[model samples]
Target: MCENNPVRFIDAFVDGLDLDALGFKRVKPKATGRPGYDPSDMLKLYIYGYLNRVRSSRRLEAETHRNLEVIWLMRQLKPDFKTIADFRKANRTAFREVFRSFVRLCRELDLYGRELLAVDGTRIKAVNNKDRNFTKASLKRDLARLDERLERYLKDMSEADTRDDDGPGGDASAKKLTEKIETMKARRERLAGYQKTLEETGEDQLSLTDPDARAMERNTRVGVGYNIQIAVDAKHKLIAEQQVHNKVSDLGLLTETADAARKTLGVETLDVVADKGYFVIEDVEACEAAGAIPFVPKPQRGSAASKGFFVKDRFRYDAKANHYTCPGGQELTQQGGKRVVRKGVHVIGYQNRRACKNCPLKASCTDAAFRKVTRYEREEVLDRMAERLADRPEILDARRETVEHPFGSIKQWMGQGAFLMKRLDNVRGEFSLTALAYNIRRAITLVGIPTLIDAARA
Candidate 1:
């Protein structure tokens, strides 16, 4: 193998790590039983396989015999396909630790800037297909359609029974209709059972193949998959932290992802920026409390925005006075009671009903008697963040530029658009290797394999 080959760096990197401490199994060979392949060697094989875009265990087994790089990297030990597959399934959770170990090595090498991070999520198709996934709403819709068909079939059968032209063909037609009706009834019963399961479990959707996968919408296309979240450092666009979630949306994930990345980077304070999907107040507040400064644009979501009326942001709030100056130059003060928006979140409604009775701007402001602007109890945090965003608006564009590179490369260049594993943990392990390969390639491109090998040893 050449000195600059990434296979050499992979060997050096795995050799330096304590696999037992990182949770790899069978670290020590047994005394009485058959000898097993060393975990470090297996780890090197996987890293090499992923880096070369050959992820299947059978393909990897073939590589050990045919490919010169795999033969040299693994020392010509070709574990069968089942053994190779079992290694990953048995030590699934440990892959994340290995990924973080490499991240720590990169941090030591100054590959991470540790100042700012861009957080985003993408939906990767799972082993489950869309037809095999069902939500409560979909189940109900299917049952209703079946019921309509059943009604039509029953009516046809009744009309056929009244016919007096006795013939074998007529009887056969009626028998076929009866069979169709029975099939539809059986399907209806099955759908009802699914509905009952959903009600009992309190889950929004159910996936037959992979129970951990969910039906999620991405880029206006709906599919059954897992949401993959990543926090990328601004300097190198390398992923600092990655997590797989089955959630349908990215509402409350900013804090957890950014906090983990912040801890991995070993920074006291870090700047995190995301898109409007992560604009939940509780999440942003939690992210800030976790020592990350978050900048997320508030989404324009409300009846007013949908109806072409003035949005809540148009009314400027005065904290000291506890009132808002509306677009019509009128003061709207907080009303008497506070309403609970969500858990640990309360908002007070503000309105100037007396002034709006005759104001000419009422039509544009609201269709109701007056405009009511609700303010959260912790609205000051959002206000401060909005001020920060206004001052440094370029960070939003920076966020887009920083996070999209890794996702695009992983999906487009790496041929990892869909996961091959069945369960969540297995897919997580698979992605961990994918991410590790991506980072390794990037580090080698930035600073050659020789430096990485030296750093690994150091």
Candidate 2:
């Protein structure tokens, strides 16, 4: 009888024919002649850490020394903390490939539906704190403070110099103040250089702990360390994730994530849904061009329509004439051939000051001296999109149900709001592993454990 045997769980869970079958090896021929642990054992250690929600390397080291499941899984071998940490850090690229392979296997088994995908970005607290973020505005404030201190030091120095030779201490005080002023000036110049770098670099924000990460506001009252974006399939809620720098807004993320999912699933096209944040006109067009349908809400900024005033939409656009006919039956023509690009469409501005000033509805039409109306050259496309969304309002509700589930579950499981790894590459690698673990758990839950084992064997 195998009753009360602790090894049963480990044997049943992690016993494998060969780690090399999964493209992992225990030894490298190029390394020095030293006793090395098996790569399979390290892989098992990571899997155990992910499964038990002990993601920190140090914590995993502690578990290997004391925890029963870890002891059983690793065969009572306790690797040092440096070894464990080095393994994860050095093998990040290989681990990502392993994650991709698992995703491929899941698709082959028909686990991922690849029909309906929800795209969303959630803020993951970065390893860097908010205080480390150096924006141009912050740098300016720091320089201003330095300038005030320098002025005070100069004033003190001048006062000491004006002293009527009362004591030799006056010269010492003058020299000390002068030195302080020079130090403050040098600091100010350094800050100026930092500010110049901030301006020259296209990145809107930077992180001290992770140079590639950006500090972004998560909500009105809260700020996050980093923003991780994911596109999850509705069928099993398996994550298709990629970490991005926080500077870029969500408006451009829709097509990128959807395209990644399509490529991963080897599908020609798919349906994607997201909130208003992803609703850039160019992104919608790009998704369509990529053969994917994006169901994202158009962001509504308060316009004249919302304020109960005459909006540009009220005016009828004469496409052939390339002009607008106002409500008062006045013709508004394009002025000075000036145009601006909005949402990837050229918007030609039209105005008629003479007609607008004399119209009965001029007060409602213009708060400006002249009434101006801007028409997008591709307004017809936007109109069609709005109509389609109106027809299927339930898509929004579906988006909420599909995308929030995985985010909520992962956040709860992680216990903390931040990432453990510093730097963008490390964070991305960690996230990839987390996503793999999530997909595996989902697959195991949807299909029985025995079925997964059979598929793995097959």
- Candidate with maximal TM-score: 1
Model 2 ranges with Cα > 4 A deviation = 1-31, 35-39, 75-77, 100-113, 149-190, 199-203, 221-224, 301-345, 350-355, 375-381
> For candidate 2, which ten residues in a row score worst on lDDT?
1-10
- Which residue pairs in model 1 clash with each other? none
For model 1, how does the per-residue alpha-carbon lDDT over 1-458 read when each residue is reduced to its tens digit?
Answer: 99998888999999999999999985323334767778888899889888888899889889989999888999888788877887888788999999999999999999999999999999999999999999999998998899999999999888888875368698788889989999999989888888999999999998989999999999999999999999999999999999998899999999999999999889999999999999998999999999999999999998999999988888999988999999999999988888898989999999999999999988898888878899899989899899989999999999999988999999989998999898889999999998998899899989999999999999
List lDDT for all candidates, in order: 0.91, 0.72
Count of backbone collisions within predicted model 2: 2
RMSD of 1: 1.9
After TM-score superposition, the amount by which residue 26's alpha carbon in candidate 2 deviates from its true location, in angstroms, is: 7.0
Across 1-458, the per-residue lDDT of candidate 2 in tens digits comes to: 14233233223433443445545545432346867778867877886677568888889999998987788778898887777877777666556565666667678778788888888888877777777777777788999999888888887767766775558576676677778888889989988887878788865555566676665656554453667788888778877545455644676788887887778778898778888888767778778778677777766454666666686667887778878898889999988764667544676788898997778998787677877887665666556666677888987887888877777877786563577888767777677767766777777777756666555555
TM-score of each: 0.96, 0.79
* Model 1 misplaced regions, further than 4 Å: 27-32, 165-168
